[model samples]
Target: MPKTILILGASYAGTATAHYALKHTIPSLPDPSSFEVVLVAPSRHALCRPATPRALLSDDFFDQDKLFIDVEQQFKQYGERFRFVHGRATRLDTEGRVVSVELVKDAGEGEVTLEVAYHALIIATGSSTPSPLHGLNSSGRDELRAHWTAFRAALPSAKTIVIAGGGPAGIETAGELGEYLNGRAGWFSSKLENPKVKLTVVSREEKILPLLRPSIAQTAEGFLAKVGVDVIRGVSVDSVSPPDGGRGEGGSLTAKTEVKLSNGQTLAADLYIPAYGTIPNTGFVPEGLRAENGRVETNPQTLRVEKAGERVYAVGDASNYARPAVHLIMEVIPVLAANIKRDLLRAAGESPSGEDRVFKEDKREMQFVPIGRSKGVGAAMGFRVPSLLVWLIKGRDYFVSMAGKMWNGQHWAKET
Candidate 1:
């Protein structure tokens, strides 16, 4: 009887753990058949969300067909050793070590239910962004593509675009819009003289990209200004009328929005995009194992869910780890895979407690904020890099190739 290792969410962290465990653990096990890895997620494909800011504004930048990779196709070579369940995990039974999922693609029935028991569970459900930027909201590839189509159709006619939040998403969006209206990039013709062609970014923080150093943040601000993006800092969006509305049915806004700021001012725009970061998708996570914001609480060193015993772990946005990114998730996978292997070995009566591996998040945080296809800003290994370097490293392709690697070469094909 193989010990089933069930993983929740097939986003970056969850999928990486599955692949690493298969590559590292099975061969080392005394009996390779002693364990099986099962990955459960809402979508049957991986959405390349980082490209959303650019893609939503312009079609030439990214191919919608390549934005997602079918989950099954990416792991087909692994054979029966791995399994991908296309469903949402609605309930978790910690005591029984079982998870209840509602299948996304059921054939005959109204709703399909599945119960999977596991020796270990990894949560990597990721997170969701607000509308007009449904970057991580859809459950499948088709739905995600639909979201992009809607956004593109809505953007062309819009004369004014207001973005809330000064994080990477907001800043990137405003940058792209600024360039589009300036006739620098994108398909939109130059509206340089059109006062109606407005682009603004509102941030609660005093500076944009607060996670970066003041100098780096300033560099980003300078670039945005050059592209005609108006920056408003130290205030938040208090309310948006047509509040829940966005571009269309699938987006957050159905029509133009009248936005109210915390400072008691109003700004009306043709489009409003919220880039305030993600809302954790941990609703199914047990309250005891979760933090205030519903992110799983994990032991800093071990990366195991705090107070949820050694069998459960979490990573990416679903975990308490702040600022989840593809780079960080890749960094955390090895340690997480090793820790799970150690636990399995102990269960098999092989390793002792002292020999168990533990994970530590990289202390030196890093990120790249691309303004458009040819210019941007970034910090790597605690040092800021110039815009040209940012463009060469990430801005050009927006790390589409990296996303391709995540999907195992099925999407975002490399140029030969």
Candidate 2:
């Protein structure tokens, strides 16, 4: 019987780990057929989160279909060695090495539970943003699709759009909207330039993109100004009152609302988008193993779950190893894959080839802020990157082309 390496979440981290394990780790093992990978996730597809900012605009700006990759189909090439479970993990028994999953069911059906035992576990459920476009709320595919549809239907009529949060999501979203409504040419051209649409971004911090250098933030602000986006700093959105007719069904973004600011001011918004604050999807994880902020307490060097015993690991936004960023997740996968392989070899009474890997958090300030399709600002390794470079790197299509490669596991490091 094959030992199961169960992976939770199907987004960037979980899917990448699964592919790395199956492609590199299992094949190099003393007994190649002694292990299998099981990936459990609520949604059937892995969301291409980077492209979501443009994806929320009209289909002319981006094809929303490309924003999601079917997770089950991505694993079919592995045949019986890989299994995809469409469910959400509700509880984890670290001592017993079993996870309790709530299988996804039809709308009217009663709940169904499943207990799956694993030899090793990887928790990579990631985190969720207030806006479904930026991150998964863990409500599954249907709700996500509905939210996309709702946003699309509402965008045309929205006269005032207020985006709360000065983080990357908020800034990126504001840029996309600014360009789309102000008529900027991108990967796809949209002739609809309605400058009448008012765009605003609210940030609690003193400046936007606080992670980047002040000069880079200023440059980004300049780009936003070119596209007619207003930046409100030093105050947060205190409360939001829905439109007179309410937020419509499912709390959709269709109706107008009133936003109250922390500085005692109010603004009427036709569309209210909360783009700040991410909640880690780790409710099933034991409290003792989690940090006070609700992220998994992970070994920064080994990527293992601290105090949860052997063979339990975490990566991506769900873990407290480093600040959450797509670039950081890429750096984490190779280290985690190598460690898991070494640990598995020892458990199977075989000598592993390489020494265990250690992950060191990169301290370099790296960020790319695309103000619009044509212009942007960024910095890498303590140096400022030009606007054209930023546009060429991410602003053009938001790396949508990489989505397929990510799902196919080709992005993993060539050597473990």
Candidate 3:
């Protein structure tokens, strides 16, 4: 008779929680089988979101659903201790401990409430990548991938390229295309159908990577420069529209909308890509919950959405525990799992004389960042491991194989 814990969103944070709890944390607690862990997500597989860039050049990467992870298979080694639900959550009641989960299929979704009551809940819906890639598509597994596929199809023929938003996504897209076009940073030894493809990044901010320290930000800017990316900083656009009534291809109907800059400048391209920012996907959380900046805001240390009365938590992009970073998920999810078990211990009246084990003051630290696939920057395990580690950790195969290994003998588990 284990208490149930329902986890939402099954990407990095959610996946890590399930794996850690099922394999490590839960077993460490008393009567592990008494604490059933249930994971709910939109899909059955965990997608390797970072590799969407490589998929642009390599057709072998286009196995769209192939990259997805099977949660059941991923955690099967844990036996009947875990359950995965494929559905979209409609609402949550942290107070009463109930979640309204909707089972979505091809044509329609079947609605139902979970039978078990939760001793704790983990929301790890993660972030999506759109302009800033702040949504489901931003993970580089969705619309952005589709957009790149379309852009690459026309690349060999296009003469100009204009990218909006100077964030990492914008820079990454520019870098990859430049590499593909010239074959090298050196124009001398390269094969290019067009060496003069106009690449411009428009950002309203005075500098790029605003969240990063100025020095580190400049380092990124320099990297972009080395790759021959033209960055346009501090210029906003009033509206986005095509001039001369759309040229080439299918115009607005088939192609992206032309942009009109606020500086009274008209910029058009064979392809227009938006690398904007992220917004919260808490619409599924119903009402009365605290969500801000298009994301749910919670105390970093506690991970409590508003009050800490019930067993509740949010992780990854869906919950803005103050700052958002992919690497943070690595740190936060483990802390989150530990905290949940601690809460369960306290709730079961199994605490050690008023000492609270459930606390959430985890620090936010970024360890690795890969620019493209081969090169980038980062610091890991407290060594500032350099960009080379980034290449190995994420740049190489985009950690697709590592993700499989995390599942303990399934997925890309054997591919490596």
Candidate 4:
């Protein structure tokens, strides 16, 4: 029997790790065919989340087929070396090296329980946001697609759309909506326009993009203003009241939903999107291995699960090493993969070359906030990056063109 290198989550982190193990780690082993990689995730497709902001606007740049890449197809070339399990992890036993999974069944059918034992475990389940429009959360691809359809169907008639959250998702979403719907001449042209809609972004923080430098945040605010998005700061959404009629036409309660702010003000919105409160998908993780915030307690340097055995590892949003960001995810992948490969080599009674990779947290401020299609603000390595460069790098289609490369493991690392 082949030893199973089990990975939880099929998002960018998990998928990249599996590819690295297959292409690099396994090949380095004396008995190459002695191991196989198994990936477990809820959805068969992996969502290209960066493009979601524009995707909400139903942009031709973000086609559903292109945004959601089939996970199974991405690994088809690996053949017997890779196995994709369509399920969600329910429990993890680090000591026993076993994981309890709930296999997704067909519509209207109950989920089937499955127990998988692994020689090594990697947790990359990532995080979830309040709205599926921002993150995949626990919803399957089909369900998420339906959500997009319903949201778009309601957009035409929605006169007022309020987005709550000052984070990247909220700001980006507001920018996309504002520019597409309310932007006048001289702004990036949009094929689909809805000028009747009023877009507002409500942030509990005093300034948006709280993680970025104050100047960068201020620049973002200015960009949003130019795109006709209203930024409401220092107020939180205290309560939300669903429409009394429930499920209005086109499956939206937009016409009647009411949002109460912390400042003792209420606003009736045709569409209310809550983009805050992102929780890591670490429910199945052992309590001892998890931090107070529900993220796995990972050793910042080694990328290993703190308090867990050396064979256990974590990366991406599920790990508490650093704040969740796409660039951070990419940075941690090679470190985690190299460490796992070294450990696996030792277990195989072979001496591995080079020292174990360590992940040093970059203290320099690095962020890119794209306000609209034509403009953005960013900083890298403690220096402010030009807006045009930011737009060219990320704002243009939100890197939708790289979805295929990401899925195929081409983005995992630079080619040797």
Per-residue lDDT of model 2, residues 51-153, tens digit only: 7787767567656566777888878888999999889999999888899999998879899999999988999999987667665568665676677788877
* Model 2 lDDT on a 0 to 1 scale: 0.83
Ranking by TM-score: 2, 4, 1, 3
Model 1 spans with C-alpha error above 4 angstroms: 106-109, 132-134, 185-196, 251-254, 352-354, 409-416
- Note the Cα lDDT for every prediction shown: 0.76, 0.83, 0.62, 0.81
C-alpha RMSD of each candidate structure in angstroms: 4.1, 3.5, 5.3, 3.4
Over 1-416, each residue of candidate 3 has an lDDT whose tens digit, in order, gives 56877788887778777777776667767777788889887766677666655555555744554455566777777678888887767777666777777764544655555544677888777665543222243232344445445556666776666777766666666666665554435435222333467667788888865644455556656555555557788887556655322222233312545677778887876666656665565776655565647666666776766652477888887886846665566656555766666777777677734433343433433444455556665544434446676778776676666665554433212211
Clashing pairs in 4: 254-270
Q: lDDT, candidate 2, residue 99?
A: 98
Give one clash count per candidate, in the order shown: 7, 0, 20, 1
In what order do the candidates fall by lDDT, top score first? 2, 4, 1, 3
lDDT of 1: 0.76
Question: What 10-residue stretch in candidate 2 is worst by lDDT?
Answer: 185-194
Instruction: Assess every candidate by TM-score.
Output: 0.91, 0.93, 0.79, 0.92
Among these predictions, the greatest lDDT belongs to: 2
> What is candidate 4's lDDT per residue for 1-416, written digit by digit as tens?
88989999998889888888887878877788989999999988888888888886674767777788889998988999999998999999878888999998887998698899898899999998777666567767777666677787777777888889998889988888887877743455422244456778999999898878888898888777766677899999888786421133335534457888999988778888887888899999878889999999999888888577757898888998888887787777778878888888888888888898999888688888788788888888889999999999888878777667778977654522
